[model samples]
Target chain A: MKKLVNNPVNVVEEMVEGYVRAHPDYIKQLQSNDRALVNARETKENKVGILIGGGSGHEPGFLGYVGEGMADGVAVGNIFASPSPDPILEVTKAIDKGAGVVYLYGNYAGDVMNFGMAAEMADLEEDIKVGMALATDDVASAPKEEKDKRRGIAGEFFIYKAAGAAADFGYDLEEVVRIAKKANQNTRSMGVGTSPCYLPQTGEPSFEIGDNEMEIGLGHHGEPGIEKGPLETADKIADRLVNDILADIEITKGEEVAVLVNGLGSTPKMDLYIVYRRVEQILSERGIKIYRSYVGDYITSLEMGGCSVTLMKLDKELTDTIDHPVNCPMFVQK
Target chain B: MKKLVNNPVNVVEEMVEGYVRAHPDYIKQLQSNDRALVNARETKENKVGILIGGGSGHEPGFLGYVGEGMADGVAVGNIFASPSPDPILEVTKAIDKGAGVVYLYGNYAGDVMNFGMAAEMADLEEDIKVGMALATDDVASAPKEEKDKRRGIAGEFFIYKAAGAAADFGYDLEEVVRIAKKANQNTRSMGVGTSPCYLPQTGEPSFEIGDNEMEIGLGHHGEPGIEKGPLETADKIADRLVNDILADIEITKGEEVAVLVNGLGSTPKMDLYIVYRRVEQILSERGIKIYRSYVGDYITSLEMGGCSVTLMKLDKELTDTIDHPVNCPMFVQK
Candidate 1:
């Protein structure tokens, strides 16, 4: 209930307005469909278009990622709600340069359906080639065999970066989609939720937990996780997350990886770095090499208290392009 | 009390350990004084050294701002307490290359005493010339006549940036100190606190407030504010902050300024953007041009729930040097 928002209903509209105005040099919202934020440096180049989005609560995620050398467009939605196909189509049409567009987003049902419909619309009505890829890297959401059923969390940032880099390298729509799939396949994430975030509209806690308890493996939107227990130390939590992620993927000794120790909204950066310290120790002990490190809030549930660890096993191409220059509002790698 | 830490008493020690290890490429802890984090890309150049530091709780503040084209060294301390003179002297000696060094930090009593003692020590022992600048940009802490009494808060980030750029451009220690002083004078900041943050060692809220109330003009460490009132809408709060800042400074029409809508840890970036939206509208109506914008968590007080707005009026020197390339772990510009 302590959200600092005006008119809970218009948070999305106001957020978009503020975002574009603040980062006016790199981003702008569509005049007709304000929810669709596109690159301010939009050019009719031959590169394939990269479009990414989801709900609005995850700031610096979809909107902040639309800039030079980053995702070209984003179709933002209401807090924790997927955008309809209208804005998706608008972004698709805006970013397309006859090289086709690829839709990438979390594996949520609403997003999948809406973005899929937008892809069909772009193909049938606009005559623009469209492809799709879903990020399914949250290992806690499903079993290894049912990986496609898993939800996307902070790992989606890596997937988007890989896809964007491929497109920036002049890859075709199909190749970009292929890279997105490969990045998704290589990425794994697990998060712990210490507390729930209250929604501005309802002014109610998304869920409840005991004062000293935390949910392990919870989804971004408070979906039930694997277990609930008294919160352990940062080292223990980092150990659990790293162990779960390693078990979900085939990454082994001597393999290099890109690491993301992401804040789940309210956790302190100190806490995330402490967790990263332990993660590095764990990885080093296992003979795994961490090629790059990111430790901060990338994607988040509104004011939710927790952290998530993501790792993307890097190949030759990914390692060379991992530092792909991006100047987005949220995730910038320069 | 919901901090994701291991040992409460060892929070600072672990934090430094984690920070250095996580960013080994850009930062490394001093072997002699582990609390001192120095730029990993150190060189024996003759340019004046830009050093920054303070208490530990403000992640990405003193520590994260050390890298190429940024500050050279940081004298880190425990949460909410200033560092001793030993680490200060250590950093001063490490970064100083014949050209001497400049010390810039928040205008806090403990910091002044400690850094002052270290400055004397460096002059007497190592014969390394040293100049100092204090960031006094928290307009809420004092009247214009007693500006030196104000705390640094988020506005100090701009001071550090200006000083670092001044040094990088091969300015002498005296000139760097002058630029830092000017940057501090031109900056102003105001923040609101919805809830208090708990210290890791104490495991208790630093201050208390009603669930439906917020303290406007509160300091970073839950210090007293100008007023306490019912939590108002984001727009109303933004208006109050902007009006107060404008009244404090004489920013005329057609002036250019940089804006920072910073989250105080737990406040969502969504709310910060909403606040920035209003901030932008007000500045536009006043005919002030926004030269650049930064919206996210920069200098945070652990997981305190609130946000702060900062403005730095730009002159020819500041405007040109504002985007000076920096690649620090926390703050980056390209």
Candidate 2:
């Protein structure tokens, strides 16, 4: 394995430690619970808190978004494993103000179970009202009718942005949840994987594919994608990803969207741009207007070689939210 | 090759087209010279235009740095190759506003020859004054006395930051060149490679290494590094890189620095963070302060597996310049 790490067992600890050390201006580890990385600056009183977290490995995903106007707190787990209820409760309590808190994360079985347990713990122990908006935007995971059951992909970036902006915009907890849910519902993502990421601890591949094959809907945790096929051109893959998303979202002519061509892990940013170019072409041909574009590794699966194309249908509010000023560690939007 | 691109010959063109479309607010493709991506918003009159460019493949390296308060324009080239004098001249003419323009790019023989030719062309044809600053921060490439012969690695991020900020801060082309040169001199970087990146066009590896072996101080373009050794732990490797940098530059106690732990391409950000943790430990132990930090893929070598650690020694002026607000498409500092 080409993974550069120390002991695999201590990967999360060192990662979180280094992350806090790297961006002390924006984030700090929770005093009691080391797993939680909260905003260094104090969250405004009576403003709803925006907490986003998930399993580790996908760096800058859950933790990179933590800042004053972005994710208020992050509860980090071990590699591809959810944080226990304890650290989640700690972050929830730390970020909570009189207005309560909202939890937004990718929709995965481990996350759903763990975050739900933490919400219950927070409610029972501290009387904190918590709202949740699980991002279920991966279109390749399930049929359109079963969108609710789909795993959240890179669309979590949009969900986190909207939720964070809404929270900072002084919206109440319920409204923040609504906005987060709306963003998740409107966003669609599909990923194609050319190579698998190895587990740092075990040095084991997440999944395997033939040297010249790729899987269209492979999940971040090496979960099954739609199908594995022979490697194709960037334009062809972009066409396939865009078609899959457009078919599920039903974006009308002249409507606007925020296009995010995200590299899974090892896919080069140059290729992502090439893919974004194709996505833009297909959208323009279909009369869909692109409001903004983000191309990079917003979320990744360790060293997995692949990419995902996500489109978040935008309205006036979502547009404003996307344009909202942000100072996150991973993403800085002015 | 796991590259997601069409005909390798057109990678640069498609990349430039896609880049301009993705960031119309910050950059636009030049009409007369498609290779140049200049500021979308009209540059302020009399402001020293800061133009940065080199080869493609390193996404967000030269092209990503273009914006109003950052790089004024960029001249893109094919993968791992320098832009011709024609496009460079066009960018110089377009960005020139009587105060002249300054060109800052990595120090490469091809780039030096091409950009030097462009400077002469601009002087003879357009009568526009041009200043130049070559980034030479790759400490592994040369000895201290031969620093001028060193290759510019990820340290270009800081060099561009200083030059762009200095130019936009109303400094003349000469002053911008001076500041950029100072940044380049003060910055030092070392990189390690575990796996080589395969060129999309040729589907050939940049270099080869045994599966259990790694190279220290490897150049991004596959130049030889220090030595081949058994794959070492992240901590041991970080120690070697930091030691080499510190030994070369006398950053004494209480002097602050801006640390950049960058991914070459395919190295996981999680691993970078782990590496950063070790780097921070070493710095803390030595009483060398880390003023600010950037931990991600700022400049990349396509899908090469490994990372580089860059440290830019900071003074008050460099500190302010580094923190100066930026709005580039690839980098945003607020």
- List, residue by residue over A1-334, the lDDT tens digit for candidate 1: 6987888999888888888888878888888798888998874577899999999787667787887676899999899989999999999999999899989899999998999999999999999999888999999999999999999999989988898888998989888888899999999999999989888899888778899999999988889999999999999999999999998888889999999999988999989888998999999999999999999989989899999999999998887568889777776678
Which predicted model would earn the best DockQ? 2
B1-334: candidate 1 lDDT, tens digit per residue: 6878998898888878888888899888888898887999874589898888999888878799998777999999899889999999999999998899999989899999999999999999999999999988888899978988999899988888898898989988888888889888899998989988899987889788998999999998888999999999998999988888898888999999999888888999999999999999999999999999988898989989899999999999887668898889987788
Off by over 4 Å in 1: none
Each prediction's DockQ against the real complex: 0.82, 0.86
Model 1 TM-score, 2 decimals: 0.99
Docking class of 2: high
lDDT of 2 by residue, A172-230 (tens): 98999999999998999999999999997788899989989999999999998888999
Worst 10 residues of 1 chain B by lDDT: B35-44
Backbone clash count for every predicted candidate, in the order shown: 0, 1
Give the alpha carbon lDDT tens digit for every residue of B192-305 in model 2: 999998888889999989989999999979999989999999999999999999999999999999999999899988899999999999999999999999998888899998
